[model samples]
Target: MRYSASHKLETREKLLQSSAVSAKRSGFSTVGVDGLMKAIGLSGGAFYSHFSSKDELFASVVESELRQSLERLGAEQDRDKLERCLKQYLSMCHVEHPETGCALPALGAEIARSDIAIRQQAEHWICQLQESWAQVLESDSLAWAILSQCIGALVVARMLATTELQHKVLKSSYDEIGRQIAGPGA
Candidate 1:
């Protein structure tokens, strides 16, 4: 019995989707092939048919996750996009829900230590993300600053033990970013 090419593509997409969730929810480095296969109801033996290696999956996951982050952060949305996107991203809801959130806060450092190929792929998406933000925010400097701050704030908020502190980090960063982007005296 052989699967059609479209079926194979569908299965591969399923695996990528599940892997993206697992990578964002847990560390990408922490999820094994068996676990990822189990997630899509496929046997571990079927894993190789989709991805050549875990490193390959890591790169794909990074690409998929960053694409999502770009969309969620209002990649090509209108002028009010930044503020609206930040309101969602810097909320406690996002902090508590890692599965549906941006991958950067959860796995940026981990991916930074990945193989050169994966790191290069990540750098491409990172620049793409910056470009997306730059489109709406106008200045490359402002785009980089906001993206760095958002990633840092979420990472710190996720690390802390208390919800209060987490919300504080989120709110403070949110307000500060809004002010900075709003320009002087804003």
Candidate 2:
């Protein structure tokens, strides 16, 4: 049966969203089209109707995840409350839920090894994040530095050996960076 264009688009979006979460949880390269399609209640063959190939779907998924992260950050735009938002982002909760967490820490390594289309999308997202952060921070360089530190800290924390170690990494990184951001000199 032929589905309407709108239905097809919606199904494609569902697939992309589901794939994004799965990819974040299980690394993009390791996820199969069949599994992603199954999660969205669609057949693997239908994937081609929405995307030319897995890479195309991957690119879309990257964009969707990036937009989600930006939206979350955007909600905390008020400069006075930026640190609170950052604290939440660098917390243990964020580290423990990669599937629903920030795309950078979840799939940064995989994205780095992906093709040009995926890499470009990732780069675009990073630029947007840097710009948004720059607007809130006193200095662009400081914003970039803070952004890097936060992402790096999250990635490292997520990679730790134990839950206690993960929490320690996150707490120490958060405290040190938070102090730096709050210091009179900053």
Per-candidate total of colliding backbone pairs:
0, 0
Show the lowest summed lDDT stretch of 10 residues, model 2: 73-82
Give all candidates' CA lDDT scores. Answer: 0.87, 0.83
* Model 2 Cα lDDT, one tens digit per residue, 84-153: 7788988888988888888988888888889887899888888887788778775688778888888998
RMSD in angstroms, all models?
Answer: 1.4, 1.7
Cand. 1 TM to true fold:
0.94
Q: After superposition, how far is residue 70 of candidate 1 from its true place, in Å?
A: 1.9
Model 2 C-alpha lDDT versus the unseen true structure: 0.83
Sequence-dependent TM-score of model 2 = 0.92
**What would the TM-scores of all predictions be?**
0.94, 0.92
Best by lDDT: 1
Where model 2 places Cα greater than 4 Å from the true spot, the runs are: 184-186
lDDT of 1 by residue, 1-186 (tens): 999999999999999999988887888778789999999998999999988998888888888888777667746666586788888989998899888899888888888898888888878888988888888878899989999999899999999999999999999999999888888876
| Candidate 1 lDDT trough over 10 residues, lowest sum | 70-79
